[model samples]
Target: MFALVDCNNFYASCERLFRPDLQGRPIVVLSNNDGCVVARSAEAKRLGIKMAVPLFQVQEQIDRENVAVFSSNYALYGDISARVMTILEQEAPAVEVYSIDEAFLDLSGLAPHFSLVEYGLQIKRRVYQYTGIHVSVGIAPTKTLAKLANHAAKQYPATQGVVDLSDPQRQRRLLGLMPLREVWGVGRRLSRRLEQQGVTTALALADCSPAWIRSHYSVTLERTVRELNGQPCMELEACPPPRQQILCSRSFSHRITEYNDMRSAIAQYSARAAEKLREQNHLARVVTVFIRTNPHSQHERFYSNSASRILGVPSADSRRLTATALRLLKSIWQPGHRYMKAGLMLSDLYLPGHFQPSLFEAPESPAAMRLMQTVDNINHSGLGQVRFAGELLSSGWQMQRNHLSPAYTTRWDQLPVVRA
Candidate 1:
């Protein structure tokens, strides 16, 4: 058996963890640069504040509805996610972290000990006790059905955070009621195609001919059907590999017209991407920089640009990547356009120490390696950030907007007090 555990309103719940005052209030977390609504509490959704609604478009509605808004605080969210995962690891024998707020636990052998519903309730209670966040769990014989069962558990309160779809009659009944698009692998395009074929529900899709599905759509869709029918096509991997492409980009709070400011933004993004690359022990041979103007403003011109540079040798070094990224920025930089966003993408990645040495570029010296190690250690220890590069401390770059919440968990100065 497989079980899916998903946190309800993950980002908003993270905020409520520290600020208990926000419980039952309308709350929303903005995306980068305070651009749009990325996450909303149940109360906010009750007011019909749709997800991804632009902040400017909903500003008046927000004020009229008395909605409480917050900028994205990833540090707090990441910390809370870690805590949740830690609790899960202790309770489950084998666990797979599906996303920032979701996980799958293998329950194949534990059925002899306790009922599935009781096991799920214990998990929910323990997670809430540790983190003050609520979660829902679903159990099924296959991963696809487990996901569907989880969706059902969220909607029906009688399930009490646990829905089991292993029974044949119950599985058919539940699948018949669920919309086709709610299935794990059926996207909007596939859903429309399935509807055109007169298959409008999960049960209908599952009953479709496998040969036709294989011919019309991908093999993945065929696998989804098998999984829906209680055949496990997907196995839980213990340790998934890191991502191959690392992209770090953001829209500015305000449009940037100056070339220096654009360069600084690009450099900052490249430095961040490089940090992630180093963390995963990988390096990239290709670096891409791009800038774009606001597409929504009628007064602004729509302009976008990109430039790619191939490194002589793949590198995770911040200095090398930032220098190459700045050069790419200069190539794509246009003088007159007001750029609203910029980003950096590092691709063609490989393990750091395993790359083929290039004859043209000199290998990293001992001194350089030591300096990089020292810089990374100091940043990790909170002595200071990576300031060896001038671009990091340049005056033209804008500050990140994570100013609202007190640093309750990370910083020593922001720790909460307790009476003895």
Candidate 2:
């Protein structure tokens, strides 16, 4: 059996964790720059304020409805997500962290020891008790069905956020009732295409001939069909596989035109990507730097360029990556155009001990490895206070988070205040 555990209105819930007064009230979390609605509480959803709607368009409604609005507080959300994932890992024998707000647990072997539904309830309760965040759990024989059960748990309050679909009849009935778009593998475009083929429901898609589905849509769709039919095509992955590439990029809070600022942004991104590479114990042989002017600014001329370099020798050191990224940025950086975004990608990743050695270049020194590890440890412990000299103290290219809430969980100064 597989169980999907998903946080309920995760961003809004994180905001409400510090502001308990917002409970049972309409709340919405905005995207970066307070651009659009990225998350909404149940009350906000009830008011029919859809996700991704521009904030300006709904300001009147938000005021009239007295909805609590917050900017994305990723630091708080990340810390809370880590706590929730830790609890899941402690309770479940194996857990696959699907996203920041969701995970899949392998519960097949534990079914014989206890009631799965009861176990799910225990997990849900423990998570709430520990984190002050509510979660919905859905258990089924396959990941796809588990996803559907989770949807039902969230959609219907009578389920109380726990649903088990081990029974074939119940699984079939739920699948029959759900729209094609609600299935785990189906997206908007695929849902529209499937609808054109007269497969408008999960059950309808599952009932289609596997051969025909494969011939038309692809093997992935066929696998979804089988999984929907109660076969376990996807299994819980206890450990995430090493990433083949690591990308670090972000849109700037304001457009930047200076070469130094662009170099600073790319340096920062490269350093971040290199840290990720070291965390996964991988070496990247290639680094790509990309820069772009805002396309949305129609009055200004648009410009975008990317440059890639293959390192003489693969290394996970942030200093080397940052240097290479800065060099590449110098090549692509254009004057006069305001750059809206810049990024770095570390690719051609290889395991530490498995890569081919360069004949001309010397192997990375043990001292350098220790230094990198020390820097990483210090930064991790200090919440990313350490930085390379190439990084700017205050780059204009920082993300626009105008309405961001304090990092209550991660920052000492922003810790929740307790009233006497």
Candidate 3:
């Protein structure tokens, strides 16, 4: 058996975690630079506030409905997500964290001792008691059916956020009611093609021949079809696979034209990308820098460019990545253009101890590794932050976050204040 647990309105729920006064209120969290709606509360959705809608276009509706707005605070969201994942990991035999707000759990052996529905209720209660985040749990024999069960839990309030599809009859009925696109692996394009072929529901897709689905669409869709028939085609992965690429980019709070300011943004992004590489214990042989002006601005001539450089040796050292990124930035940056965004990408990754070393090249120095570890420790502690020289203080490259909530869990000064 498998179970899928998903946090309800993840970003909005995180915002409401500390602000109890906003319960049952309409709220929305904006994306980077407060650009567009990324997450909305149920009340906000009821008010016809669509996802990804620009704030300017919804300002009147927001005012009329007294909607709460917030800028994206990743530090806050990441901390809360870590806590939620911790609870899930402790409760389940094996867990696969699918996303920041979703996880899959293995429940193959526990049924002999306890009811699966009761166990699901326990997970919900414990998570809410500990983290103040509501979650929906869906249990089934396969990952595909687990996802479908989770969708049913979320859509129908009578389920109370728990649905089990272990019974074949119930699974078929639920799949019959589900749109084809709502299946785990069917995407928008696949859904359209399936619709044209008169396969518009989950049951319709599952009823197709597995070999026919594989030949017409893909092996992945064939696996989805089998899984929908209650056969397990995927297993829970306790350890996630290493990322093939690491990217760090963000839209700036304001447009930048000067090459030096853009250099600072690239350097910051490279440092972040390097941190991720080190966290995963991998090295990157290629670094790329990209910068672009706002294409939507009709008054200015549009410009966008990117350049990649191969490192002499694959490395996860921030200092080396930052220097390489600055060189790439210099090669691609066009002066006199108002750049809206800049970022860095690290690719061609290899595990640190597994890759063959060059006969002439020296290995990473212990002193350099120690220094980076110390810096990372300080930053992770949230006591203070240390930066490389290229990451200039007051660089004016920060993203817009005018309506950001306080970092209630990660920052010392921003801790929630209690008054009598």
What's the residue-level lDDT of 371 in candidate 2? Answer: 94
For candidate 3, write residues 249-355 as lDDT tens digits: 88888999777788778888888898898899888999998889999998999999999998767888899889899888888877789999888899999886666
- By TM-score, the candidates rank as 3, 2, 1
Q: How far off is residue 302 in model 1, in Å?
A: 3.6
Residue 217, candidate 3: C-alpha displacement in angstroms = 0.6
How does residue 350 of candidate 3 score in lDDT? 87
Models ranked on lDDT: 3, 2, 1
Candidate lDDT values, in order:
0.85, 0.89, 0.91
CA lDDT, candidate 2, residue 176: 91
Root mean square deviation (Cα) for candidate 3: 1.3
What tens digits encode model 1's per-residue C-alpha lDDT throughout 259-360?
877776777787788888878878789999988998888997799889998877888888889899888888888888888888999999987567777667
Q: Residues 278-367, candidate 2: write the lDDT tens digits.
A: 999988999998888888887999898999999877889888888888888888877899888888999998876666676788766678
lDDT minimum window of 10 residues, candidate 2:
392-401
RMSD of each: 2.3, 1.5, 1.3
lDDT of 2: 0.89
The residue-level lDDT of candidate 2 at 119 comes to 89
